[model samples]
Target: MYRGRRRVSPAVALLLASLGVLSGCTNAPPPPVVESTSSTPTSEPPTEPPKPKVVVAGIDELRGGFNPHVLADQSPVTDALSEIMLPSVFVPGEDGERVLNSTLMESAEVLEDTDEFTVRYRIRTGASWSDGPPIAAEDFVYLWEQLRRQPGVINPVGYRLISDVESRQGGKTVRVTFEKPYPGWKSLFDHLLPAHLLKDAPGGWSDTLDYGYPASGGPFAIRAFDLDRGEVVLMRNERYWGPPAESDRIVLRAADRSENLNALRSGNVQLGMFTADASTMEALRGLGEDIQLTTMPRPVTSTLLLRPNSPQLSDVRVRRAVLAALDRQALVEAGTGGGPAANLPAHAQVLAPSQPGYVPTEPSGEFADGPDPERVARLLTEAGYEHSGGKWIRDGAPLNLVIAAQFRETSYEAVANSVADQLNAQDISTTVVTPKGDELYRTMLATDPGVQDPPRSAGIDLAVAARPVSADSAATMAAQWGCPAVDPDTGRTSEFNMAGFCDQLLQPTIEAAVTGEVPFRRASERVEPTLWSGAVALPLYQEAQVLAVSREVSGVRDGAGFAGPFSSVGEWVGAPGESYDW
Candidate 1:
């Protein structure tokens, strides 16, 4: 007879199994039956919920100060965070072209295009920050007001031209009027910050984003930043209006090349972007097809700044002597660390190698492979310096200049050391100093104080630093060489200008270029020669970076020129993740 037997429920079966009642064969299981002891019902065993799916990306640097507009804070981590956390009006499309971010903005147009230009931006309806406030004109006004007058901003020229930022239509529509025609107006107002929270924050503009964002407008929100642990986690923003992030969490793990490779091997990290060197590239190539490598060129050009603010280097002839004493080819070879930048030796002072209309502006007086001994000696003599005991002496004091580079920045430190070595070999007294990057840029480079209320010393005589060149060429030129004005309130000079020194003769030309009254090419042509002859700085190479993606991670690929792999982080999928390692 074909008789069917009743089946026990899952919970009962689990309880029975725990009571030694489960049997493989149905016929055999009829031998014994388990009974409950009390009125309580049996329940299934507890199982853990699925772990949060996470994708960790390995990067080289992860210092805070993520305000995208700040110069000292412009790093790989900043760019990655801003692309995913902050909303932008225009972003790089699939083909690297400027495309309007339809998610945040409805439309942007040139309303008035006469001598005084005006741009109108309409924020999308219902587009609000992670907080309750709407993304509107106040954000634009905040960025402009800060960048235009901030001491250590990235590029303020475009923002400085703006005469006013007018809020219309209940603060949704923003009308920005430029004092002069700004052709690169589209580049302004990127990564709009939460003005309402940060405007009167205790830390002010410099410390607006030091810890984490107050509100998120993009797909992810900052969960935590544990600097000591070198890990920053971003979780999917519950209040995000756009499509949900593919991964539940994304982690930015700051590590070295070996540490990154180890994480990839352990399936801990799926993507890595590091400062490429010969050793790292060799090992990465040995991995065969396990990882994909892409070379990226950054916007900054690595240069050796001979700061004229230093009394020792104030004389142009001495500065020229220092430049002519080094073998720049050797500097490039050592500084590039046999990376992609070794081939792309920069020749322009104002424009980056990737920028449009960039031309090699290497001066006619450039140093050769081996420095010209005669030129070095003559320049030093002309600067009232005499070589005594194999060291240059001026006015009974040895001309000992200190060259500083940021500590932990391998490439820049290499360049500074190499420069010092070359100078020592050429009988030029030089000392090398490596300070923390924040101190080097914010405290050392930004200040050139005189004897006053808070007396300060000229910290670094010269610096091996990267000068960021943006879409606005005029702004770049002015930032490097423009004359800083005197501040009446502080009774001190403006620290906005890099080099802590500027040429009055080229100031008018820089201003004209910033205002768009003169063409970029013409202004740069006039300003570049003075910079080179004056020995203000010597451009070595552009910042070349690399991106590596593990095949284990899906949707990990290159973005475009100057676009990092994190641009599409919302779509990445990874393997099952374990609990947070902390």
Candidate 2:
């Protein structure tokens, strides 16, 4: 320390001493200094700011089900990816009501509620997919055509009510005529895929969006997705029509509970949204005040779906008998245990019990509380089944049922075992088959085996699967029960009916209720009794989605319904600090 001043280098000091001696010797004749002028300043150059880090978000699993609309292709990573990359007609506003996204639409309004309810949608001229195609009616038609009958879709109710979709303005504008007024129409076409890319490619639904969305219309687009490395990266879409996203990039990393927690503590991941146990939740709590943890109800319910298309279970009486034979309370207990799902016992068929305005649409006394053995027996007898040698039989073949459950889901496996045991006790020969999720949802549950002349014996008649139920009450009702209308012109039948059963009689009422023709409550009142009597679904519980975000990232909040934390991805940015390694 040189007298509270920065010490000068020895070389500079020597140079200074030499200059002083030379100036002293030539005191009279000091040469006029010639100035060499340059435009550049003599000061040191300014240092550039450090580049921002890629926002790493930890997710439970990268199951790679990136198609948010399809139930089978639903996971946290998928939901997050879809929310940021997919286009929507109406985004959830501050009040959670459907508001038009100015970027995607020029105008969307009801043309008239005439004989056939008509609505018009005009796409913004500049709106185009990340790939190449312009965002147009073709995309809308593709989704409606695929969702209406292709099966495994989330919200197809409003699409089912559409009698026709006519494209105008060189395919930029769409005129839709619904069979009735659809109040939840805004919920349709939230995640529109590129029609030119996926409409005709084989495995149109499941295989296309397996890794990531082929095209993005929103502010971000998928850059790279690697399941082996457990990461899906999204970069800013340079071609996005609206205001650019504030963040440079978003990376979703697949991780287990412990690893996810570790990443959060180590700051390897700034935000995390994953499924967590009590211990994991506690671990998150221990991460101190900086971590923001939230628990939201996932739009999924564990359900025992009885498909009526099986020749053995074709009769409505037989389907109801199957419901009567099983003890639902035991099934729920076996599946949920003491998990988060245990708390939200699903009571209604359309709207999950956790949803707002959820009244137990479970009819008064069709064994609303428990199994009814007498009801099972009477229904079997009425359906022409004869009880002989402790087994129900028709045409000398025993009443054997094949139940399919996805092997990947532990809770569902337990639920399936419970269902099998309950049915077996009632003298029903039941065989529980554990199929891969793809086979279970895409093929077994999706295909109507009974469509063949002699019903296919190899396929499953019942499925224990996760049914995603959204807060859109009308959409849920129609998606679950709205009969896939037979188009007399095209002659295409419903392919992926979640429940193989179809009720033509109740379909119109369902249509009326789903479309704004009948109020949701009144429609549910008129629909639930007959719907429950059909005994199609045995909903166990609503699954809860968990999110843990650190203070390092900002602008996280719940969206309208199933949008999750990723809804605000456009506004999310990494906190300024040291550069990140990842």
- Native-referenced Cα lDDT, model 2: 0.77
TM-score (C-alpha) between model 2 and the true structure: 0.82
Per-residue lDDT tens digits for candidate 2, residues 63-158, read 656677776666666677878888888887776567888878989988765677788999999999988779999999988887766556677667
Collision count for each candidate, in order: 0, 2
Candidate 1, residue 288: how far the Cα is off, in Å: 1.3
lDDT of 1 by residue, 183-202 (tens): 77777778999999999999
| Candidate 1 displacement at residue 308 in angstroms | 2.6
